[model samples]
Target: MAEVEEIKNLETNKCKQNKRKPWDDGPCLDRWEIEKFDPSWNPSGMLEVGSFSRAYPKRREKHLLKCWPRVKSALEEHGVSCELNVVGRYMSVSKTKMTRDPDIIVKARDLLRLLARSVPARQALKILEDDMAYDIINIRRMVVGSKEDFLIRKIRFLGHNSSSLKALETSTNCFIRMQGNTVAAMGSFRGLKRLRIIVGTCFRHDIKCVLWMS
Candidate 1:
């Protein structure tokens, strides 16, 4: 009986030792699979080794830093200034995440008008607004989104100046809206104090986010 008990204990210990691995938890595919790896049988049809995906996981800060500088530089090349602010929720002893959700936001007025138009513009505005309003004050700034991406929405792309005015009134409070056909400015952050509250409230991406304002 004692011998039998000892054997059972050994078996249980071994079972515990077989811990699950990272790949066992979730597959990392979004990072990009390394292609043309197996150059033996078919030199042209090599399968992806998946080095990049395997190398790191997506962490918001890292990803933003990695891409943001290049993106900012590119924008400057075209004569548009760029800025980024970040807000943090918490810190964790995490793994190799390459990208993370943007806690910091980027913002600029009519920044992308020259590049593209419409849905892409609206999408960019929405993302920017969401991030800016994030609780992380240090990292909060209204960042601009890509007009190319904005084109996807296709709906809140454009509006007659008169209609947008109605939207501004019904959408937010105490803010002034100056949208004369094309350019727009819808914000409660008016008159001197620059409260940024009223506009903050009614600020919708496409439907309400101002086109341009002086």
Candidate 2:
């Protein structure tokens, strides 16, 4: 009985020692052979879509038509597709069957948004690059006064001949456009950060003061 018990203990220890961890398992067959039999591994047909709308698309129709071909071709090079709906005043981008990089769709979306904000198509294409960024700062709610007061602030923000505006752009290395009540800016990340600070100071203090400091 003692010998049998010792044998049993040895067998249990051996079993524990022989037990393989999940990470210890090796592939039994080639990766291609295994994937070939996987019914749920198909990713080629998956689609992702991004849509955009603007307040005034009619005004941009001609511009869009002129740039759409180039935009479509550019996106196609990255395995994405784009479409413009003149009647609906919207643009849409989607991943095609050839799309391998998931982040390309997001870049395409940003491209459409920049274009919708009246950014020149040539400049807007820069959003497709890795280090480019953009921001839309709403100045309408930044003031605490009437419309006239806001207008005054906006005027101050853009000095005579837009000298103050150009100075801000130069100091920050950003391209800025004042569209309605929002300021659209695009550049490198560092430039955009500096731009936000300059815009805040322009609205909070005097544009002349900010320009002088810069």
Leading candidate by lDDT? 2
Candidate 2 C-alpha lDDT tens digits along 1-214: 4443443345445566657577565677322221112313445644654443333367888999899899988888877877888877788888777675566678888888889888889989888766678898987877777899888989877888898788888888898989888899998777886677557655654344244333
Which window of 10 residues has the lowest lDDT sum in candidate 1? 131-140
TM-score of each: 0.17, 0.72
Q: Which regions of candidate 1 fall more than 4 Å away from where they truly are?
A: 1-145, 151-165, 173-214
User: In candidate 2, where is summed lDDT lowest over 10 consecutive residues?
Assistant: 30-39
Query: Per-residue lDDT of 60-116 in model 1, one digit per residue for the tens?
Result: 345444455654554343233344434432111111122121121123232232111
